[model samples]
Target: MSTARDYGLDEDYEWPRPQEGGWIADDLDELPHLPRRTELIDGSLVFASPQTRFHARTVGLLERALVEQAPDTREVYRNFTVTLNERNRPEPDVVVARAGADTGPKLTRLLPGDVVLAAEVVSEDSVDRDRETKPRKYAAAGIRHFWRVEENDGLPVVYVYELDPATKAYGPVGVFHNRLKLTVPFPIDIDLTAVDRRR
Candidate 1:
């Protein structure tokens, strides 16, 4: 059976790392060695195995493309943690945020509202959580944009999701191949086709 501890997850990693000895902050040094998995869902931890070669390629391509294409007003993060709530901190493969005013915390470790875009590259073990559960979770957390990178959907497969305030969740759908470009909430333009285009 898989366990949260097996993946080095705290019952509250999504709440921001708190003061040491504060119950949720125990064993800070051991966090890096824990197994990696989805930490956003309640009741159970989402078990994720290591990334496959194609998965790594997808994440790498997206990270590079976003870093190059995102406006200077935005910062992009790859494979880094971000808070979604009190108990969910699944690190999407990439995160894009508006440039901040030196708020001490780096742009990547954001509160629920700071994120403008989050992307997940599909790995066989995590496709469902990435394409389905995460979109709802990100919407519930008030994120504005989300993308799903399909490693198997032909040569240029990408799915983009947007939150529709009328529905209070991610609803607008975009499907494209080789590349899809989008204008973000205020100060950024994103092109995902360069990243998801694969053989």
Candidate 2:
């Protein structure tokens, strides 16, 4: 006996029927009564599952670390969608973008060109998307940097990647555990173990 509110929707809400070619990226903004963190991938709506403690804390620590270390011309955001193209708009767990993309409160999404680095803290339900689909799409869209964070032994382990311009594919930068430090994407340093620390 689940009501619409149980799923974070209005009681009178009616789901949007699938279109022949799927939904365009712009349809996401026009859709009403969608759940939080709804993403459009290949013209289909993808709803986020409930957040886990591990996912929340890892994203929080990473966002905090990035915010503290990011340069004035860069900004950090969480759970916001990036418009990769007409048919794909996926939200990363954490995003670092050029300051110009922060168009104040009314902004709905970021253009691929505006993003500097995109990070995903892997969740059980998102392994396929994070590991296989997202990285490939992000690279194809010309994003320069990407990070995939996984929980191991209750700690964060980061795998970093840099895009190869000629190939338009990501090349492994490094795999970091315990601590994450980088210089290429604006000098980031984070204590991965802080996910367990009291905030």
Candidate 3:
């Protein structure tokens, strides 16, 4: 049978086993030799799959667009985790957080209230999480806006949602095909078709 020795883990290195109540968000920051982009969902560790070219390009494009359009009061972050509670801290592909949330270089997470919008680019390996789980959690955390990007024929189709405070649920705002224009979170316009274009 394969063992920790076979994987180069130290003989004394014990894996962080799941807790009966699930792992808390703080446990992620303390674990040694954890993989990059590891997340906590319902107190369990969730590791990210290898990112694909399409996912990378889409995320880059979105980040650039948001950075250019986001006002000085809002800052854009890529692959940063937002702490929703003690047991949930999921990283979105792109996050537009309030400028005050940028504590410093050493800061590791953002609170939900610091975020204005959270976006995810759907990948084959994360279809369910991106489409269903993450959005549901983001909405429950009171994030104002959410966007899900899907690859359709090598182009990105963005589905936008706005959270309804009364219901604490997301309502479809719009679906952008070639262009994405919005004025709610902030004035923004982006060319969704430029993912494959030379910068």
Candidate 4:
């Protein structure tokens, strides 16, 4: 039998099994004191170590840039969970949604339809998920835009993608290094180098 430590899970981590009511978003809400970052993927709990300084810097830089460039009608948030489905609630590094999209008394999760853009910053522990699994799921859920930020030789590189409605897949739009200029969801200009410098 596999143990939590064998899977690099913390001792306090509660593994969700299908037989035991399975894991859902509500379960995450119940555990407000979880030490590590956690997400639900296909009813399985995934735990990740805390972000590195560079990772946090990049996420913050992107959030600030997006907020500054986005129109007031759009909302920009960082480290927010978007409920893709019953068993999948991934907290993206940054997300942009239509203003007033979340109407609950208190903000909970953003449904796929409520999201216009979702962005992820690559981390040592999350390369595959950020590059492959997430894009497929996000596209299948009809998220229009997805951006991935990766580090190359200690500098930030942004890959922009847009979902093709007919195919339900993301097509590469642009790869930016120093500056990012796009006019899809809205006109925006971002200085990629600034993200590194801010560190």
Q: Report every candidate's CA lDDT.
A: 0.64, 0.89, 0.89, 0.83
Using TM-score as the measure, what is the rank order of every candidate, best first? 2, 3, 4, 1
20 in model 2: Cα distance from truth in Å? 2.0
- Over 1-199, each residue of candidate 4 has an lDDT whose tens digit, in order, gives 4456655667766754544656876566665544345777776677765688889888888888888889989999888778788788888889999898973334767888989999999998899999998888899999999999999876789999999999999999989988889997999888877876744
Please, what's the RMSD in Å of model 4? 3.4
Please provide, for model 3 over 73-139, each residue's C-alpha lDDT reduced to its tens digit, 9 standing for 90 to 100: 9999999999898999999999999998953244889999999999999988789999999999999
On the 0 to 100 scale, the lDDT of residue 35 in model 1 is 51
TM match of model 4 to true structure: 0.87
List ranges where model 2 is wrong by over 4 Å.
Answer: 1-6, 10-13, 102-106
RMSD of candidates 1 onward, in order: 6.3, 2.2, 3.3, 3.4
Cα lDDT tens digits for candidate 1, 77-165? 87755566555666788888767723224333565577888888877777678878878888888888888878544343678788887
In model 2, the Cα lDDT at residue 102 comes to 47
TM for candidate 2 is 0.93
Best by TM-score: 2
Q: What is the model-wide C-alpha lDDT for candidate 3?
A: 0.89
Off by over 4 Å in 4: 1-21, 103-106
TM-score, candidate 3, is: 0.91
TM-score of each: 0.72, 0.93, 0.91, 0.87
Question: Per-residue CA lDDT of candidate 2, range 59-82, in tens?
Answer: 999999989999999989898889
- Backbone clash pairs for candidate 3 read 23-43
Evaluate residue 65 in candidate 2 and report its C-alpha lDDT on the 0 to 100 scale. Answer: 93
